[model samples]
Target: MAFDYKNSPTDKTFMEFDRIAAEMGDIRLVSKKELIFIPSMLQEGEQVLAFTCGVMKGKRWLVTLTDMRIIFLNKGFIFGLKQIVVDLNNVNAASGETTMFSGRISFQDGAIIHTLESVWLKTVLPFSNKLRDVIELRRGMKEEKKTFSVEGDDFVSKIERLASLTEKGFLTPEEFEMQKAKLLRE
Candidate 1:
């Protein structure tokens, strides 16, 4: 069942939604009310990947993983909505622990740690593993972009970037020197 939201989904969003349903098991762990409300909180172009209903600080929350970030959503009895968001780029690590019946998932970003407890044990491993994998993939892509940033720069600028990359250990000294010589010859 599709929930109504502010914007219509694009083809990319539909593909991602299908992938999430196939891989993560349809997000049935959260409530129907939550399902109805979640799309409203999502930014345009953001795709929901996985989610688990859990407790934190004695309040129930629906912890959701999206392509762009992690969202902790709670609708209070008296109050309206309380949400905490952790950007994908800010996630330093993800870990989980499972007991006989339930599990806990924790995400550490810098000095802060966000944890959701009482998740179904079956979802713990898959969710945590996917979280870690996504973080690694995003970081890898960012590094690759950085490595190719010297493109379109002037000759002197390219050599300076190579030197900087060498200093940062992204390039070896020999590789930097070789590239510098190649650029000089051009």
Candidate 2:
């Protein structure tokens, strides 16, 4: 049940994975001490160590994102880092007070570190820990003085702000879904 992002996954395309897996499937992956994947500097089947984020008590991960796709024990890859503007609405015409949903994925150590972020109601939020991690890691490296940004890709840097709003229950599920859907359309 892979998502057909090229054509946009329909509601059914997005929801069927769970049902199919629940009937007869098992999630599986592997872990290592330190995996290293240097883009364009290595061949396939090459990675030192890696781990799945959440699995059996944090001690093991049966599967994890390696390359741009989910990987298991034996497969391997070599890939370039890319940031795609998928799911955009009015991107060619965006000005202000626009809602957006987008992701910036990095290729490192044989994995795609996905930073899923969205914006709505003048607030931006990142809904994934990986995105938060990316923000923190980047923050530590640069001197972006604002809590969130109001510039290029600034919406993505505002995960904490969005999370705070979400915790305060400011955004309704419908709002979230609508904004998310709109972003995807862009």
Each prediction's Cα lDDT score?
0.78, 0.30
Off by over 4 Å in 2: 1-28, 31-50, 53-127, 144-186
Query: Residue 6 in model 1: shift from native, Å?
Result: 5.0
Q: After superposition, how far is residue 169 of candidate 2 from its true place, in Å?
A: 63
- The number of the candidate with the highest lDDT is 1
For model 1, state the Cα shift of residue 159 in Å: 6.6
Report the lDDT tens digits of candidate 1 across residue range 46-109. 6676877789999998788877899888887766888888899999999989999899999998
Model 2 Cα lDDT, one tens digit per residue, 64-183 = 222222332212234333222211111111111223432222222323332212212222121123333443444454445443344436555454455566668997666766665665
lDDT value, candidate 2, whole model:
0.30
lDDT computed for candidate 1: 0.78
| Shift of residue 173 alpha carbon in model 1, Å | 28
Clashes of each: 0, 12
Per-candidate TM-scores read: 0.71, 0.17
